[model samples]
Target chain A: MIHVQGLRKEFGPNTVLDGINLDVAPGEVVAVVGPSGTGKSTLLRCLNYLEAPTAGTIEIDGLALTAGQETRKQIYAMRQKSTMIFQNFCLFQNKNVLENITLAMEVVQHIPKERAVDQAREILRQIGLLDKQDSYPSTLSGGQQQRVAIGRAMALHTKVMLFDEPTSALDPCLVGEVLSVIQQISQEHNTTMLIVTHEMQFAHDIANRILFLEGGSIVESGAPDEFFYSPKTERAKQFLQYYSMKRYQ
Target chain B: MNFDLSYAIRQFPTILSYTGMTLRIAIVAMVFSVLFSLIITIVRYYRIPVLTPVVNLYIDLFRGTPLLVQLFFIYYGLAQLFPIFVNLSGYAATVIGMTLNTSSYMTEDMRGALESVPRGQVEAGLSVGMTDLQVMRHVILPQAARVAMPVMGNEFISLVKNSSMAFTLGVREIMAEASLLGTSSSNYFECYLDAFIVYFVLSKIITILQNAVERYLNRRGGAVR
Candidate 1:
């Protein structure tokens, strides 16, 4: 479970998040959808303290941190409760795919090498990249690399997984493979997921609930059926119209 | 200015005798400089409080001056100021001066390579629950070392050539031996030509080694896509 309250982020007097509040239940898939620059990515980053919030409290799986009231150690501990997948697929270039997946498990988690490699192989099998295990990230396509990144995140077994536009960097043909992998993982595992993505259709399909953010605030959030079919806010309606028009055309 | 082939040919055995001294000086200086520069690069990368600026000043001072002057100062000037330095061997002074001079340039080379690693890589490491120190040791340094290899190879090759200057301090290296043999035999051309051949061959060997190392690194993996 994850709880956020009064989350505020500021950059040189430019407020990025304005006292945002949210709650996510276990096994919930919440898709954050909004126009660009609406702080969707920043909000996800704040959950893991990747970008420290100017003011807020984040609680995930019993680990809680309130901005300015937490020590660095507490912050690090809180970060361990969650893992993130980036849009650009930032795999360790120096490591082969198997080594990339096993690195954190062995180094950070202190899992024995044999067990870590076994776990990594299992995750690779799940992602259907077992053959590419020995290949470096540079040799993989953007889609294959992103799957490896997803496999790496899955291996951590964190309470929540935050994804920042995971498919935004992929080619049109490659988007389905990555999204299907994400959908399959969410279905099979009871992990809470908060995904910030522009793929409205994928969100409609995968997310049980959708958050509509505008001007750094959640203007409307509800079950996908209500949020997509009958948005209550004028800003959300206009934004969805623009999104649908741009997405289809 | 007769080119005496026989004398030049005969000078090989004598010049070869001093090759060991030159190799020793260059190897010792290279090892010390690489280790020292690694320290400088790490300190500067972390910006370690007061020490960072001190290291910067050290780099600037050594890099700005000629190595010959630095050697003379360490060997001749410092000995006058401190009695202990009066007994400092010319070999020690040469090694100290070359290490100090070469490490300054190496520090900058390594720092640039370290910085060139993308910010995304560090963030990715942190996102995976690795601490800053772990990220540096596991991810950043390995990539930075790969990036810095060619430049480091060039620095080492230059260091080999630069060690020739140590002759002025009477270290009895190749150049010093060549000059002594040249004056004694009155075959300056032949003796100096032999010295040039030795330097050329040594540099070629270093270049070959550099290429082999580069190939090995590339075989490990390509740069981040």
Candidate 2:
């Protein structure tokens, strides 16, 4: 489970996230959608403490971090419970696909190398890139690289996996491959996920709920179908209009 | 223009005898330079409190001044300024001077290399729960080391050439021995030519070894299997 309250993030004088409150249940997959520069990615990053919130309380699994009282141990413990995936698919360029997946397991989780390799191999097989396990990420196509990234995230087995534009950086032809992998993983129904994405159709198909954000807060949120088919707020309606028009073209 | 071809050929064996001395200076300095650069770069990379500014000043001090002046300060000047430094040996002063001077340049190279590893890799490492130290070890260093190799090779070659500065401090390395032979035979052209040949060939050998290392790291870290 993930719970956050009054999350505020600032970079210099710019307030990116403003008084955000959120809750995600175990096994729930939430998709956050918004116009550009609306803090969708910042919100996801705040959950994992990738960008420290200027002020907030974040609780994931049993780990907790609150403003003014957070310790390094608490923050890292929270991080171990929740991990973020990036749009860039930043696989360790020095490590092969299998090592990329297995690295955190060995280093952070302190699993033995042999056990981590076995688990990483299982994840690589699941992502349909078992044949390319020894290949470095730079040698793989963008689509294949993202699969390994997801596999890397899976290997950690964190309770909450946050994705920042997982498919936004992918080629149009390769987007489906990654979306399908996410879709398949979402069905396993153990890891809760918060994904910020521009793929409305994929969100509609994969997410249990849709959150439409504007002005640094959730302006409208509902079941994906309801939010897609019947947006309540003007900002959300305009967002859908803009994205859907681009989709049809 | 009064070159002595036969005399120069005879001096080759004498200068080549000191190849080990030149290499000992370069290799020892290279080892110490690498260690100091790693420490200084990591300290600055993380922006550790108090130490970063101190390291920055130290780098500027070594990098801004001449190595010859630095060797003088340690070997000759420091003895006059401080009673404790009176017993410092010439060989020790040369090694210390080279290590300090070389690492400043190397720390700059290492900083660029470390920065070249994309910010995304750091985020990926942290997102997976690796601590900052773990990220530096497993993610940043390997990639940065690859980026740092070529420049580090150049620094090592430069150190080999700069080791000649030790001759003025009464240490009998390549240039010191060459000067002695030149004085004894009055055949300065011949003896100096031998020193030039030795330096050139040693640099070539280092280039070959550096290329081999680059190939191995490139093969292991990048491209197809």
Candidate 3:
């Protein structure tokens, strides 16, 4: 389980996240849908300590991550339990697909080379990119690179996976392929996932719970069916109307 | 006006001996410089508090100064200040001075490489439970090394050419030997031209070596560009 309460983050004078609260139950897929510059990415990053919160508490799997020396260590430990896939794929330009997957295992987990290679090969196969394992990220298509990024995350075997605008950078046609892979992973693995994305159809289809964010705060969050069919706030209605129009055109 | 092939040919061994001395000093100095520069780079990369600024100032001070002045200071002035230690050999003085000089510039080159690593790569390492040091050591450093090779190779080439300045300290390197020969034979133009040719050839050799290293590292790193 992931829990966040009154989470606040500041960048100098600007408040990127202003007293937000949320929770994700185990094995749940929660999608945070918001317009651009709504601090969606910051909130996701703060969950993993990629960006530290200015105030409030985040507890994951019974480990409390607040602001303190001890909490910092706990936050680090918590990040190991959660894997993040960046929107840009973030594949190392210097490494081939196999090396990219095995790097974290060999260096961080201290897994032996033979064993790590075996595990990496298996993950690559799971992602359906075993043939391209020896190829560099530059040689792969956008969708393929995203699959490699997913493979890298899966290799960590984290309990929670954070997808920060996973398919936002992909071509329109390619987005479906990456989304399908994530949907497949969500079905097969027991890992909890929190995805921040712009694909409204994808959000409606895969998210068991949806949080609509505006101006750095959650306007509404509940089962996707409730939020989609019966939005409570005026802000939620406005957001849905805008998403619908964009989809129509 | 007659070109005497035998005279020039006879002078070849003398030139070759001094060239060897010059090459040895440059190679030794470059090795020392690369080691020290890497140390400074690692310190800066990790943002080690009090020491990082001090190292930065040290690099700036050495890089900003004229090498000729540094050579004189290390060879003559420092020696005068401490007579017992002043007995250090000319070869040692030259190597020490060149190493200090090259390292000041190479430190900057190496720091640029370390910084060029994508933030995503560092973040990925940390996300997987690697400490900051481990990320830098195992992942960042190897990637940086590949990006840093071409620039570092240039520094090495410059170091080799700058090694001629050892002649100013009476080290009897190629340039100094050429000066002596010109004076003795009253063939200043011929002797200096020969010295220039030697330096040019050596510079070309370093360039070739740099290209070879770049190709090898590029292949290993899987750099498409």
Which one is best on TM-score? 2
lDDT of 1 by residue, B161-186 (tens): 88889889888988998999999989
lDDT of 2 at A228: 89
CAPRI quality level assigned to candidate 1 from its DockQ score: medium
| C-alpha lDDT score of every prediction, in listed order | 0.91, 0.89, 0.85
The candidate with the higher DockQ, 1 or 2, is 1
Whose TM-score is higher: candidate 2's or candidate 3's?
A: 2
TM-score of chain A of each: 0.98, 0.97, 0.96
Every candidate's DockQ is 0.69, 0.66, 0.58
TM-score of each: 0.96, 0.97, 0.94
Candidate 1, residues A1-249: lDDT per residue as tens digits?
Answer: 999999999999799999999999999999999989989999988998888888989899988889989888887787788999999999998899999999999988999999999999999999999999999999899999999999999999987999999999999999999999999999999989999999999999999899988889999999998988899999888988998788832
As a whole number from 0 to 100, the lDDT of residue A51 in candidate 2 is: 84
What would the C-alpha RMSD of candidate 3 be, to one decimal place? 2.1
lDDT of model 1, residue B22: 91
List candidate 1 stretches off by more than 4 Å.
B223-225
Interface RMSD, all candidates in order, equals 1.3, 3.0, 2.2
Residues A1-249 of candidate 3: C-alpha lDDT, one tens digit per residue = 999988999999999899988888999999999888999999989888888889888888788777443465676687787888999888877789998898888876788989989999998888899999889888889999999999998988888999999998999989988999999999999889999999988988899999888889898888887888789988888888998888922
- Listing every candidate in turn, what is its Cα RMSD in Å to the true structure after a full C-alpha superposition? 1.6, 1.7, 2.1
For A4-77, candidate 2 gives per-residue lDDT tens digits of 89999989999898989988889999999998899999998888888889998988887778976888887788
- Computed on C-alpha atoms, the DockQ of candidate 2 is 0.66
